[model samples]
Target: MEEFKDQAMEQKAQNTETEQEMEANFSDMEAQMGCKEFHPGDVVKGIVVKVSSDEVLVDIGYKSEGIIPAFELAFTKVDPFALLKVGDEVRAEVIKEDREGNIVLSRKNALFEEKIDLLEKAFENGETVTATVIDVVKGGLLVDVGMRGFVPASHIERGFVKDLNDYLKKTLDFKIIELNRGARKVILSRKALLEAEYQGQKESFWSSIQEGEVRKGTVKRLTDFGAFVDIGGCDGLLHVSEMGWGKVAKPSDVVAINDVIDVYVLKVDREKEKVSLSLKQLGPNPWEIADKKYIVGEIYPGMVMRTAAFGAFIQLEPGLEGLAHISQLAKFRVNKVEDILKAGQEIPVKVLEIDMEKKRISLSVKDAVDLQKPESEAEPASEEPVKEIAAAVEETKEIQAEDETETTQTTEFVSGNEE
Candidate 1:
């Protein structure tokens, strides 16, 4: 019994020593954690313990939890409940100790530091980033690119943007135009990215386009002389002269804003990056039918559209016009074109000569008037005798009687043969 008690006491002492050693080791480890060494501006890694609407409690392996205010939780204002949850480990900056013995931490300051590092690498590599437009302020826009960034109005697009409100809630790709860690300012530009993309498309369009190839284009804008059409990648000039076969006094007369039209690629200057387009070239030329349709000595109807000092311009068709000299305005002499002819008057005109190459036709109004009737059709009333008129009428009656007698004889002979 005594031996058993001694062995039991020895075992109990050994167990107590082991327990004391463990406690000492645990205390040394807690001291080594150095929670007290954490000061303002020091970064600490912590796991989230509790999350509220406005604040987050984090366990930094310290005796007391660290409290992070909502305003200090992100690069911008944020709700702690939306960001942090229990058991989520995060890195934070220690601001100071509060009166409640809680360590004050700022997640935004820590996140700001991390984003600066990322931006430095991005700027060095010439990389592009995506961001959302948060608000439009004076002279520029505020965006979120993992941090608050300012994009000037001039940097929003290739041209000046009048309505900055259109960019609100729009997500766009941007190039980091300027970044400063010391100033804590980040500037972004969407225009730079668009320009780079257009440069590539312009090159491809220029190489693929061939003369005479038809392309669908949109009428982007109109000038006094032409319409600037956007044919996918580049703006092409569609001159008023090439709008159609008919005369167009102004570019707006042919097309309106945002009109879709098929245009022929007339010319391409790769060196200058210029394109010439034509809407008429896509259709058949009206001059092609002029030679076949217009014949010399043919009398056709034409409208007197306008009168010149020397002659009158008569329109035979939509694109075909001919000149009638003042001398041919009437059979008799006229002081002015208005004396015998008026605008919008339709009259028959004889084609005297056709110059298809020059797109000109010499028309004679007098000849058309003179060719009304031939001398063989009827003689003069005075010269015509009454006896000749009566003889002609009697001959017409005799011929009709002879035709009836022949018909009766033929019918009687056929009936007798059948009998």
Candidate 2:
């Protein structure tokens, strides 16, 4: 019994020394953490111990856990449970000590200090930053670039945007155009970034583009004379005359805005920075085969496009036109071509001649009319001869009959006298 008591006393003494040493080590660690050095405006690093709906508790090695109210957690409204979790390491600024002796902390202030430095550096270096569109206010958009940033309506795009709501909840890249730390104002521009990209593309396009090459383009806008097409990064003019082989009354008839089409690069004036594009050149040229399609003396259906005092212009096909002179309009003398033929009149015309060298075609309406006559009307000479023969035969027969009648009368008279 005595030996057992002695062993118990030794075990108890050893346990007491171990507890004292552990307490002393904990005190030294608390000193190292500088818990006594905490003051308002001081930044401290800590680990998240608890997260609730209204607040977060962080262990900054203080006597008690530091309290971060939900409002002080972030610049925007956020759920504490979503923003923080137990054991998450975070940095916070000491706001004050509450009456309950709990250290008040702000994660928002700490983040602001850190983000301000980055924003300033980006502004000075002309670097781009990513941001989220938060709200669309009057004349501009509000974005969250670590803090609130303003994007003026004019700076939203290269062109005007009719609806700002389209950008809501969208993440886009932006350049810091203006920044005022004292005023807490940050102005950003998404257009600046886009413009830079466009300019770069334009330079590359100018260097590589060549005439006679085919390219795809989007119709940007339409004018009375032509359409402006965006080919890659640069705009080229698609003239109305080059739209098709046939005459185009208006550019809108050929293409509308925002239409994608294939275009042939006709000319590139580097000195003027102008490019001329053609849509018709991609297909076969109708004039090239006009001689084969149209033969002299052959009649073809044509439309009278327009008539002048001297002649009427007739369209045999989309790109092929022929001239019918006033004399050729009809067999009779024609003083005015318009009196005989009007615009939009459909008629058959005989191909008189095709001057391949001059690209001119001569047509005759009178020749077509004569060739189109009925077979009986066309054989007028033969019919006249037949009629003459018939009349002569009938006249001879009548003379013979009259002679017979005279002879008969004379015989009858002689016989009656003799009787």
Candidate 3:
């Protein structure tokens, strides 16, 4: 029994040795085939075991070592330090055979094929890819899309790009907008990626916001209606009505392009991603203090800005204007308001009335003139009726004298007739 058990163990050990030897022989055969079959333009798999100033050594199990020029290690720039490191496994194409019987390899060509594969997958799936801008060339920027790719300057942003060099050395996320592998043409868009992200982020931000938050923003554009401001990477409308408590003739009067401003949140609608902001709400209302500065019978100097048949309007400040009625144009002699007031003219007026809620101020130019003149001189003479009464009395007296003269002449004539 003991002899039989030892015999079984010996057989098992012999079987294990044979399997090991077979594996070793297979490995050698594979190595020999790899070395013998490799030729120029053929692809080979290897590990980067050594890096030198002029070449990189790749171990492909060949009898003669494979060598790659230092420039090929980087694929573009000749940076030996950045290109290859020990223990990095890479695929390369056989470029040539050196006189020393060593195989020369190229990593750049291998990388090109790999990039083509990745690009095909990305285009098929409509996926976003990230790239780094290597340099800014005429008409476009050279980018690395896992390999070298071209990004037209027009496709860099939503608007015109002023400085192309600003994008150099910058990694950007982009979409494969167009690709033609046969023609070796590819088009990438950074704007498309930004727009998609902007839409989603804007919706999410709008959903999270409520009333009563101060936001930092940049002025994107100006129009007659208002200015479109970029608020925290999203756009919001700052309507003319919400621009200020005082009047605003143009949006540029308050904000300029690329200006940074702090705005108070008025409303936000996530369904539309529409947000409203108020720059006026940041300060006290000027109209609230208007009543305190102006009151009935108070005279103040103002600038004339507009004129009408009923009144002449004066601007107290940049925005506030008050109307002076035609009846209050002057103390007495002025027949027309335009005669004394013209646009852009400076004038003094007295406040006759004020309605804060209505935002109306009734001003009197007559009162201002009266205050400047002597009271007696300001009082107009009452002449029409008095002159008429005096003329009537004189006419009565003349009629009575004529009647007496007629009576005396008649009496003298009768006495002469009787004699």
Which candidate tops lDDT? 2
Output the worst ten-in-a-row residue range by lDDT, candidate 3. Answer: 369-378
Compared with the true structure, what per-residue lDDT tens digits does model 3 show for residues 244-274?
8767878898899899999888888766768
Tell me the whole-model lDDT of each prediction, alpha carbons only. Answer: 0.82, 0.86, 0.77
Q: Flag the better candidate by TM-score, 2 or 3.
A: 2
Question: In candidate 3, how many Å is residue 77 off?
Answer: 4.4
Instruction: Give the Cα error of residue 128 in candidate 1, in Å.
Output: 1.7
How high is the lDDT of residue 279 in model 2? 92
Which pairs of residues have clashing backbones in candidate 3?
A: none
375 Cα displacement, candidate 2 (Å): 25
Residues 111-168 of candidate 2 have per-residue lDDT tens digits of 8788999999999999999999988899999998877899999999999999999999
Instruction: Arrange candidates, best TM-score first.
Output: 2, 1, 3
lDDT of 3 at 235: 81
Off by over 4 Å in 2: 1-40, 44-73, 76-106, 299-304, 307-312, 324-350, 364-419
Reference-based lDDT, residue 278, model 1: 98
